[model samples]
Target: MNRYMWIIVALSISPLSAIALSPEEKGLEIAKEMNRRDDGFGDFTATLEMTLKNKQGEESVRVVRNRTLEVPEDGDKSLIIFENPKVVKGTAFLSFTHKVENDDQWLFLPALKRVKRISSSNKSGSFMGSEFAYEDITSQEVEKYSYRWLRDEDYEGKPAYVVELDPVDPKSGYTRQLVWYDQKEYIPLKVDYYDRKNDLLKTLRYEGYRQYAEKHWRADRMTMINHQTGKETLLNWKEYRFKTGLSDSDFNKNSLKRAR
Candidate 1:
C-alpha cells in the first residue's frame, strides 16, 4: 500500500505546484499564450470610421482603410490611408514595427506632396489630432513589455486576469498599464494607461469581439477616453477580410503616396 500512498501524495502536490508560479512568470506565461493563440493570420484589410470628440462634445469623423501584413520573424507591417473628409483625404501612414528596435513610421501628405518620417521621440504625441498616440497604433508585441500578474477578478460580469504591463521602451508615454484579459479567450477586454507621472491618463475598452477563420478574434469597436483632457476617440471597424495575400511591397514608404 506504500506505492498507492505515494501516488495519492503526488496527485495532491501537483495542483499546488501549478499554482506556485511567481507573479512575473505567470504574467509572462499568460502573455505568451495570448500571443500564440493569435499567431497565424497572414494578412487582413479593414475599414475604420474614426470619431473624435472633444471635451465640449464637438465631434469630427474620418474614414480610413487599413491593411496589415504579418511578419513571422519580426513585428507586423501596416499601412493606413484616409479615404474621406476633404481635409485629410489622400493622406497615408505606414509603419514597420520591430520586436526589439524602435518602429519606423512615415506619413504622406497629399497637399504637401511630401512624405514626412515620424521620429521615435514623437511617437507619444497625438495621432491625427486624436486621443490615440502614434505609438498606440502600432502592433503590441509580447516582448515589448514586462508584466506582473496582479490578480483574478470579475470584469464586466466576466472572469478576467488583471495584469500590469510596464513598457520596456524608455520613450513610452505610459509608466504602466493595467490590462483586463478575458479568462476564456485570453483577449484584452480593457486597459487603463498611466502617464509618465504615474497618474491615470486614458482608458481603452474593446467591444463586440467576433471570431474570424474560427481561430482569430477581432474587436469590432474600440473606444479610448482621455481623462486629462476629457477627449475621446472611437474606432469602429468593419469588413474585416483576412488572408488577402498582402506583400511587403504594399507597406513601404513609397507605397504611402500610392495608397489612394
Candidate 2:
C-alpha cells in the first residue's frame, strides 16, 4: 500500500480513533449501541417467580407471567399478570414507556373490577411492595437518562464500562444510577441506585445470562438489595418465548382487565 493508504489503516486501528468522543458523548454512544442490539426481538413472553425478603430474612414468593411488545419509535409496552399467589391472583399491571417522557402505567384489581391509573409522581413507589420501584420495572429508554462514562473496570471477571445515568425527570425517585455494563455483550450486569439525597439506596445485580437468537441476552435471575431497609427482592425469570405474535392490543389498559 502507498504511504497515504498506510496512514489510513493505522488511524483505523489506533486508539486515537476514539479521541474525539467526550465522556458524555461516549456514554450516550454506548447506551444507544446497547439499545440498538436489544431492538428487534419484536415481542416476548416469560414466566417470573418473584421472591420478596424482609430485613429479618423472611421470604415470600409469587408467580407471574410477563408479556412485552416492542414499539420502535418509543419504548416498549408490557403487561404483567399475577398467577400463583391467591391474594394477587388475576391482578395485572400494564405499562407504556416512552423515550422522552414519563411512562403510563395502570394496575387492574380483580376484586375491585377496576383499572387504576398509576400517577407519574408515583413512579418511584415500590412495585407490588417489592424492592423494585415502579420506574425500575419500566423499560430503560436511552433518552430517559443523561449519561457520563465513568471508567473501564473489571467486574465479575469481565471487562465492563462503568457509566453514571441521571434521570431527566425531576420526580424520579433516584437521583442517579451507576451501571456496570459488560463490554462484550453490551448488557448491564449490575446497577447501583442513589436516592434523591444522593445516598446509595439500592443495588441490583443481574446474573445467569443466556443468549437467545444468537444475539439477545436475557438474565435468568435479578436481585435487588435495599441498603437502608436491609430488604431484598429476587426475580427468577424462566420460559422466555420471543416473537410470540404479541400485539399492541395485548398491552392496553383493557388488556390488563382481561389479562389471565
Candidate 1 wrong stretches, greater than 4 Å = 1-19
- What TM-score should be assigned to candidate 2? 0.91
Residue-wise lDDT of candidate 2 within 117-220, one digit each (tens)?
Answer: 97756879888789999889888898889999999999979999999999998889989999999998899999999999999999999999999877789999
How many clashes in each structure? 0, 0
lDDT of 2: 0.90
RMSD list, candidates in order: 3.9, 3.4
Worst 10-residue lDDT window for candidate 1 reads 12-21
Q: lDDT tens digits, residues 182-243, model 1? A: 99999999999999999999999999999998889999999999999999999999999999
The worst-scoring run of ten residues by lDDT in candidate 2 lies at 12-21
- Angstrom error at residue 112, model 1: 4.6
C-alpha lDDT of candidate 1 relative to the true structure: 0.90
